[model samples]
Target: MKLNLNKKYANHTFHIDSYDSTSIQLHNLASLTLLLELTPRAEQLRRIIIDKVPPTFRATLPKLIGTKGKPILRRLNIVQQRAVLKAIAANEFFLIKGMPGTGIVL
Candidate 1:
């Protein structure tokens, strides 16, 4: 029997050709495939993330706020300001999560 899938599933048409009932399938099977593909790359990134930042660099990051000026910082609340600072200071990656109207971008 043919099934009508959503347009979002269009990009994953290859899965239909490769379907196998013996294997376990999750609700978003492509996510599992993506995770598998990303596992090795994540391991590589983990090594870089684990590397220590030099003491001098870490010390200078706080001073940057003063030298760069505070016009932007003055507009944000305490939490948003801290998030922006952390994002700036991050060596590899920084993530901020907030409600839709919380303005994580600024």
Candidate 2:
């Protein structure tokens, strides 16, 4: 199977080829493998698991935070923002979960 992906955060685009398999599970695995290979976060996860080191966490959300010079019209809610800051300071991994349309992005 061939998959084309555009990086949402960067100006890059590429195609990945995953060989067809008889089972859907195999195809899903192939796609997941491709994703792991493409994302740097996967490497962080690996280091966390193998080397027992804290993962370096970074997040970029245009709607939540402004760019280098420009200012944002709105900012993330104070509570959520504080939580994220605390997690990063503590080197903790946090999972933000919310229902659809809650404007939560993670």
Candidate 3:
């Protein structure tokens, strides 16, 4: 079987040479080893994962007018509205944990 790693290594083709229940061997071990080395993309990802980069607070919640010209947020419950506001105000990352059917999106 042939395998493609990513867009950066799309030109290189890797073949499966051997396989077992535990592991699979590629025909070109050198190519696979190259993937272990860190690239610029990997470095940026590491920084973001470690929170070394500054938070991005560019997004804002949109104001949707209802049929009666009332703001859509006014219709949401206080807790839901607060959650949405918190998510919009997040700079780096925001995580919302709730049970099923809690009306929380992402």
Candidate 4:
């Protein structure tokens, strides 16, 4: 992404450095957003942290056990994945239950 603060005429030109959104990052961001969306206002001010992410995990879960990208968590059950996501969203969720450290949140 690039921005030009130059004042020029209609014949002027400009160039951007470079930028693009990766699917992995997009997926991660989307998942995080969903977590927030799931959280309610009452729990908004607490300290929360995501502890773990399971291997061979479902993309859009709380809805299903197996899934993938694009609308990742869309077709799954919103109920199950709700609490964890909600708590995180509220910023009151903490101490992830089963994270073995690396390979989680990727």
Candidate 5:
């Protein structure tokens, strides 16, 4: 899948598009940039995953769009946010634990 992100953090309207973005660098960057960039491909991604884009990367929504990040952010209710946070925490544990062992209690 093709994805593009505009770097609003940069003084200029920096943009990049790639299918070659399969590397960890791209994945991590995209994970980081989800909230800050224009992310024109957002609607396309929503079809595949809810909150597919992380909030950390959204560009401050221009005044026109409302307080950056707060505007276009997927309107996740409190319960949803807590569930997502829990999932992310679990994923972090999985990554840090590396290969699970028999010691795993669950």
Candidate 6:
């Protein structure tokens, strides 16, 4: 794959001409390969991290997540209720995982 740099390197302090051709080309190729390999994982992890954070951190998120609304006590089982409350109050990331039938709401 041909990796074309979008920015003008001449504008930056470091000029492309300073590096030897072979090393610069190899570095670009390695960078392109590393970026392609990690891009999806990085994006996925970003969404996961953002989602796990408290809704209060983002103004729009609370509305989307329905934090302002009254809790539907009947809809949630004991475990589900606890999980939901904990998720709302949690300062850090948390993942709720379970097998089928065991409600894991996060």
Best-matching candidate per TM-score: 1
Give the TM-score of each candidate. 0.40, 0.28, 0.35, 0.20, 0.19, 0.30
Order of all candidates by TM-score, from best down to worst? 1, 3, 6, 2, 4, 5
Clashing pairs in 1: none
Candidate 2 lDDT by residue in tens digits, 1-106: 8554444536765457534555876877875675567478767666666577754455644433334323322355665555445455444465456753253534
Worst 10 residues of 5 by lDDT: 91-100
RMSD of 2: 15.7
Instruction: Give candidate 6 regions above 4 Å deviation.
Output: 1-71, 99-106
**Sliding window of 10 residues with minimal summed lDDT for model 6:** 52-61
lDDT score, residue 95, model 4?
A: 38
lDDT of 3: 0.59
Off by over 4 Å in 5: 1-22, 35-96, 102-106
Candidate 3 lDDT over 1-106, as tens digits, reads 8664687687887766645533334544654555445987555556665556754554554554223324756777777776667666776566667773285644
Over 1-106, each residue of candidate 6 has an lDDT whose tens digit, in order, gives 9665556554557455465688888897875565456577645445555455333322233553455434674576778766766666554455578863385755
TM match of model 4 to true structure: 0.20
Among all windows of 10 consecutive residues in model 2, the one with the lowest summed lDDT is 65-74
RMSD (CA, Å), each prediction: 12.3, 15.7, 14.0, 15.4, 19.3, 15.9
RMSD of 1: 12.3
